[model samples]
Target: MNHVLENPVYSALRTGDSHLAFGTERIKYFNEEVSPYVGFAHDDANGFADLYELLPEGRRVLYAKPIPAVIPQGWQLQHEIKGLQFVYEGSKNIEGDFSNIVSLADEHVDEMIELVKLTKPGPFGKRTIDFGYYHGIFDKGKLVAMTGQRLHAENYTELSAVCTHPDHLGKGYASALMQHQLQIILNHGQHPFLHVRDDNDRAIAVYERLGFKVSRPMNFYFMKRL
Candidate 1:
């Protein structure tokens, strides 16, 4: 049997994040405004076919797995991202100076979307803040660095959208923001995990220092219904 984290999107949609899920029992997806992720209860050709029919033409969706899958007919492959999954290994609770950290809310969506657009920290959407626990740092009232929670499978929660504006690169904002998020997830009695591009050595090193270990190799497939 595969670990729940192996297919986190499905596990999350069925569990902790169920309230935000859409689609059938066998296949689940987040609202397009929240996330582009879609997951299947189990990998099957019929599942893919169902997804192809469920979504309209040219609708793009992201699927992740421990390994790549063969794209069946009626779907167009757009991009394939090779990444690594990291699970938190430390037991100590992280303490950070969060005086400047502010909890993000619905009113912050426009700035959040703009920051995501500039930083390209993955497929963040207008409703992505709905995942809750999004926090950010502002400089002169301008949003600069931020991070948030994404997939939640059982006791495992994913740390996502970690990014710092280009102008604020060397101020240790990313680390501070990440530590803030880590503290929150840890305090909630959930294990925090994350996925990062395999080649991001700097980020991998930072995550390792923060007590996250590489759990497995992962891949993200972006495809569109035809």
Candidate 2:
């Protein structure tokens, strides 16, 4: 049987993040300001046509799936990314030194965006923090490293925006922050999962060490309504 993770974004919108979703029941998407992701309730390629009808021209969106999708016409394909999805399978909570970590709030959104720009950890926007549970490491009052939750699909929560400042690399900040997230999600009776570019060896290694097993390969389509 196919699993929920195979269509994670759709699963998330239908379940955990339903409040942030909008669109026809068959074709749903997050608020553009929060994320550029869209999903279909079923694997039918015709769902893309439903999304195209719902979105305005030039509206950008990303579609991800465990298997490659056949792009229907009426959309401009900007690019594609090969990705890997991982899910935490460890039995115990991760332990870490979280002394330097601080919970980020509305006041920190600007800093968070700036950090995201510098580190390029993935698609992050002003209201993305509304996903909640954002925590960061500070150095002399400057936000340097952070990780947060996204795409909560029922019992699973995605660990996203796991990035550290270039100058702060090798200090274990990324690992520490992820471990903190892992502990929190596991404690809440939810499993943690995330997607990283297939070429991101460093991140893949860190996740493996943290007990996240590679669940599947994914295809990411970045496109816009035509």
Candidate 3:
């Protein structure tokens, strides 16, 4: 049996986040509005079949593992991303004044999307904020930096979308936001983990300073239907 954290997205939807999950009993995916992640109940042929049936033609999804040799019917591989998984080993977040951080809500989605567009943190969409527990810092009434939850397995939750608008970098916004989310995840008795591209050394260093250590290399495959 695979460890639950190995396939956090699918395990999340199937277990802790069923309300946000879609697809068959054997596979699960977030609605395109919330996330592009798709997870297989089991990393086997049957799991691939379930994804093929769930996604529409040309729809792309993030698979937790590397591309499998067996391409299921009606699906074509778009590309594969080699990613690194970082897990926070610290039992508690370092003390920081998350005082300026505000709980983000639906009204803030537009600003959140705009921030993501400018920062290129990762895939983000209009409804992604529905995943909840997002916090952001506003300066001059503008939303400049933010971080929030994503993949959720039983014992872990993913800290995702950590980004600061270009003009806001070096101001400690990213660090503050990260600390905020980390504390939230820890408070719930769950460890927070995250994924980053191998080439993103700057962000990786920041995470390391915050007590996250590299756990393993993971793969992200984007697929579309043939």
Candidate 4:
């Protein structure tokens, strides 16, 4: 497979148009109340320099880097790099049985909050839900696995917030939900991409087996909050 195909982060950076950086892409949001930049590189040389220059003097730019490989010079290794993969499906074929969790006009917000908590709870997750468009897996009337989309840049839509409850894992729930979401995104004439830690061998293997490829190594830099 091609290098970019092996590392989705690089693909996102090269393909995204709203913002530009060394190895990261900008997922623009409509809300002016929020910070303009959401996702940053874990080991982005040019991006880090740009961000550092943009920060106000004496103020720190706090963030995390998901490094795909060795630490680049001038960058302090804060944490281990994680595997990042990309999957593209021309047409989604959702198999098995999985119920979709709809967030109507009135229920969307609360459902989103709950879904974020159930997934990865953090500022990133918050930013994701704020962009809306999330789906959940229902088990006996309870929300289980969920897959959603975020960060729209032209014809590219990122497939994110894919999570399954611990007790509900190993049941093919995540793959099914993701396939469903991928189909929807493709139907809109857009491609799908996502990020995963490099050390996540199991997840990486699963994605590769499902036709996803390791596009390129991406770095997630985690700066100390000021």
Once fitted onto the true fold, the runs of candidate 1 whose alpha carbons sit more than 4 angstroms away are none
Native-referenced Cα lDDT, model 2 = 0.90
> Model 1 residue 52 lDDT?
80
Clashes of each: 0, 0, 0, 29
Return whichever of 3 and 4 wins on lDDT. 3
Between candidates 1 and 4, the one scoring higher on TM-score is 1
- What's the CA error at residue 75 for candidate 4, in Å? 10
How many residue pairs clash in model 4?
A: 29
Residue 125 alpha-carbon offset, candidate 2, angstroms: 0.8
Cα lDDT for residue 16, candidate 3: 77
Among all windows of 10 consecutive residues in model 2, the one with the lowest summed lDDT is: 89-98
TM-score of each: 0.96, 0.96, 0.92, 0.63
Instruction: Give per-residue CA lDDT, model 4, range 60-161, as digits (tens).
Output: 222323333443334444444344546564335534454554442334445655755766522233344544456776778777767676555446676766
Residue 66 shift from truth in candidate 4, angstroms: 8.9
Q: What is candidate 1's lDDT per residue for 110-217, written digit by digit as tens?
A: 999999999887999889998989999999999999999999898898999999999999899998999999899988999899999999888898899888999998
> In model 2, where do residues sit more than 4 Å from their true spots?
none
Per-residue C-alpha lDDT of model 2 across residues 65-109, encoded as one tens digit per residue: 877877779988898999999988875746677888899999999
Clash count in backbone of candidate 2: 0
Relative to the unseen true structure, what is the C-alpha lDDT of residue 9 in candidate 1, on a scale of 0 to 100? 88
Worst 10 residues of 4 by lDDT: 27-36
TM-score, model 4 to reference: 0.63
* Residue pairs in collision within model 3: none
Q: Stretches of candidate 4 above 4 Å error?
A: 1-80, 89-123
